[model samples]
Target: MDVAEAMTLLLSPQGRLDPYPAYERLRAHGPVVEAWPGLHVATGYAVIDEVLRDPRYVVSYEPLPQTTVAGWAESPAVASIARSMLRANPPDHGRMRQIVAGAFTPRRVAALREVVTAQAAALVAAMAERGRDGTTVDVLDAFAYPLPIGVICALLGVPEADRSAFRTWTADLTVVLEPEISEAELAVADRGAVALRDYFRDLVEARRRTPADDLTTALVQAHDAEVGRLDAEELLANLVVLLVAGFETTTNLLGNGLVVLLGHPAHAAALRDNPDLAGAYVEELLRIDSPVQVTSRISSVPVAPGGVPVPAGGEVLLLLGAGNRDPERFADPTRFDPTRPQNQPLSFGGGPHYCLGAALARLEARIAFPLLLRALPDLALAGEPRHRARLTLRGYATLPVTTVTRPHQATGVEPRRTVATTSAERRRIARVSAGERGTPTGAGPGTP
Candidate 1:
């Protein structure tokens, strides 16, 4: 396939199934290829890295809504997402990031290894129980969806009751993140945005009344302690962004990693035997099949990624999935080998706007996968797994599998094994609305 045909498939619903072939074809056209006038698609590892790291290339999602309709800023979702670190550039992004990052340090994230382990253990045990009767279980609906939401809610101090609402909120926000969406989709996203923003606002007020040692309390303190640390909008917006991003990226990682690991039983056994391999395993998994597939940036001035010139204000679609699989970056790019030393995936992105909950996401996968393997040693794919029909965020909508419950044979993965995964799993209504977007970076990274 030529670059045009490749780009076409890469953006289509069919391409979402597996864009690797098209990525290869795109890379064949050199690192940066102009797909249209004033638009480019970047496919090289080094070049995309350079663009991500360069401050000259800004996220620039502020003016995107103006193209859709008048007073687009009136929409809470647009304002909340656009205002957060997800889209902010230099000074604003830096300031907002410092506050959130400080609260979400590596030490803090590492502390959640226990939370991840405990929750994952329970989820896996439940999955085994559900499939014990020879019933095929949807891993995405059963195990993948709940683990990340539980951890994020624990960290954010959101009550257990309110956690269920996040599924709908996250789904709506994700649709909004797409480059091309319908007016109806936009309206759904707008309503979700408003709901999420209001929820956080109420949450902040509650924290003020009864502060707890959680992320929300920390943010509330930051806002109340300083004159201009975090205003109402920025605070609420960041809170909403963090929760959605935290859940979205990690959920995809768990689902995607499960399918990848189970496909290669040897690697899954390796992880079951030695959990330390999880970091490398998850890294390789992310490199081969990234959750956040594409991120874009606009040139602040005349810039060239791979000697291909991009005029000021031009947008470049950074095919992050392509970069991760670049032949120059990794030997035998298509293969999934965890042994590769010094592995770094473009999945979490880089530079100033890197994912704030990246450590949290990694920690969740690093802990969850081992427990899953140990708990479900006989787990095998029970049916044809379905991938979520979306371009930017790649993951499973339903990953079916079956296994016998080894209650007496295997020890409980967690100390307290009472939490049951019996909650109603909501089936996501898959929608595909692809059209020409006026600005390439529609909503900031679903992960960013």
Candidate 2:
């Protein structure tokens, strides 16, 4: 099919399931395809990378709560996101990120690594128990959803009971992030946004009354300071963003990663034998099938990537998933090769607006995948998978898998799965023996 025909199919249900073929057709034309007037779609690795890193290209140049976009304030969902760092540009983006970056610092993430490891173990054990009777369980429901959401809620100090509600809220709130937002979708999003705002508003006050040692309290303290580091509205907007982003991407990653690894049993066995390859395996899976697929940016001035021209004020919808599998950048991009050298995929995004949760997401996958594999060695797909019918945050809606209960120790328990001899030891093998890999940032929350 031709370029426009391919683009149409991409947005169709068929293309949503597998956009790679359409991506190949688009990329063959050039690095940047002018899909329509005033709009360009980037399908190549180099061009997408350039667009992500360049400062002149930004999420939005307009001020929030004051943007000229008509009826923006009408939808609480739209208004709140506009105030978030995801929608901010330049000085404001930096300032907002600075205040929240503390929670995801190396020190904090290192600490969180331990928490995630424990959570994964618990969930895996539960999965083992559930599948012990020889019945199938939804992997997405049993493991993927709870593990990441529980960890993020722990960080944000959200109660376990309350987290169940957020699955619906986040789903509704994030529909606003889709490429085309219908009026019906906007109404649902507005309701979801209100629910979130109300919940966080109460949580903020509770933190004020009695501060806790969690991200929410830290943010509450920052907002209430005399300097007014973060205003009440900004505080609410960011908190909502964090909660939604914290789990959504990683949840998708876990689901996507498991479906891929389990489909290739040999790879799963290789990982089970060599625990140290966890990081490399996780990274490659991200490249092959990213959780967050497409991101967009607007140019403030004329720029050319790969000598393809994009005028000032022009918009480009970048297919980040396609960039990860670009043939020029990755030899045999369609195939899974964990040990590929210099493997840097635009999964999390790049430049100043790179995903803040990249490391946490990486660690979660690196830890969870092996644990699941070792816990349920015979894990295999139980039925046909159902994917979420959306382009931006692509993942499985239902990944049913059957499991075989493996033998346990004399204590009638599976011995706790031990990691490598040491943390440094694992990192050593992952980097030196497997291949050196660097985190490449691009089009995560930056995408819409």
Candidate 3:
């Protein structure tokens, strides 16, 4: 298949379920292939890396023009996302990044290591309890969704009780990032954005009145400082960005990582045997099946990536997933090897727009994965996992997993048999169980 046909398949629902084949077709065509007039797609590692790091190829939302979603640009959600560093360029991006960089320093992220480990262990224990009686638990809800949300909320000083609401708002609001989102999804996203902004407005005010040892408090100070590093609108928008970006990507990473680990029990056992390997294991998981599959850029000036010229203002989609699996970049690219040397995946992106929460996301996954394996050694897939129908962000909507209590850890409770007769019924049961347990039923969170 050619690039066009491959891209068409990739954008379809079935294509998303297993885009590797489509990615391979695109890569085989050329390093950089023009998918449409004035629009290019980078499938090779070298070209995608160059495009991401080159200043000439900038984020598409630099000027923050009207979105394809009619009337959405005027919506609070769009406005916030527009102002965020994720979509900004040059002065605005630099300023926004610098303002919050202090809060994500290595020291700060390291401090959260304990928090991530604790939260992961707690969530895994709860999941094990749910499945101890032989009941199937949706890992996406029982574990993956809650761990990152709880940690990010703790970092931002968001109340624990409000984490589920954040999950809901972030999930809906993320649809706005989809390139071909429907009008119905756009409306829902707008509502979520407004609700999130309002909630943050109140939270910021409270933080201003009573400062705490959290990133939000520090941001409040920055906004109110005599230097005025950030304006009120910038503060609120970036806060929303942080809250959404902070948890969403990591949540997907955990879910995707677990799916991969469960699929390869040997690797899962290796990690369980030596938790320290998690750092490398997480990197491989990221490469083999990245949570964020693709990102786009607009040329600020005439530039060429892989010798394919792109005029100023032209757009290019950087296929990170394809790049990660580029044969030229890594030996036996399709193979999942945790010990692969110098493992580098575009999962967290690159350059000035590199995900600000990369360190935190890695820390969460590195700590959470091993802890989860240790806590639930007998974990196995109980039903067909349901992947969310999202193009840009990919992860499970329902990952029903069963765990058997070891003889030594038996709680004397009989396991409940899962009685769903069909995929739809299983999904319904998972959603109902998630709701009853006060967990987020949808995909956990989303990143840019």
- Which candidate leads the pack in lDDT? 2
Between candidates 2 and 3, the one scoring higher on TM-score is 2
Per-residue C-alpha lDDT of model 2 across residues 1-448, encoded as one tens digit per residue: 7778878988888888888888998988887888887778998899899989998898865643333434556789986688777888877787677665655645446555655676677667666766777889898888888877776676676766677788889888887777666677778888899999999999998988987566677678777764646788888998899888888999899999888887788899999888899989988999999998998898899987668788998888999999999999999998998999999989898888789888778888989888787777778899888998778888888999987664351113343543112333223322321113221112222112
lDDT of 3 by residue, 1-448 (tens): 7777888888887777777888888888899988988789898998888888998877874446544667765767677788777788878777667656655656556655644554555566566667778898888787777777766666566775566677789888987776556678878988888999999999999988887556677678767874646788888888899888887888788888898999999999999999989999999999998988888899989888899989998888888889999999999998889999999999988887888678878888888888778777888899788888776777888898888654225322222322112233223322232232322222221233
Instruction: List the candidate 1 regions with Cα displacement exceeding 4 Å.
Output: 61-73, 413-416, 420-447
- C-alpha lDDT of residue 232 in model 2: 80
lDDT of every predicted structure (CA atoms): 0.76, 0.77, 0.75
Where in model 2 is the C-alpha error above 4 Å? 63-73, 226-228, 406-448
TM-score of each: 0.89, 0.89, 0.88
Stronger candidate by TM-score (1 vs 3): 1
Q: Lowest-lDDT window of 10 residues in candidate 2?
A: 433-442
TM-score (C-alpha, index-matched) for candidate 1: 0.89
Backbone atom clashes (below 3 Å) for every candidate: 0, 5, 3
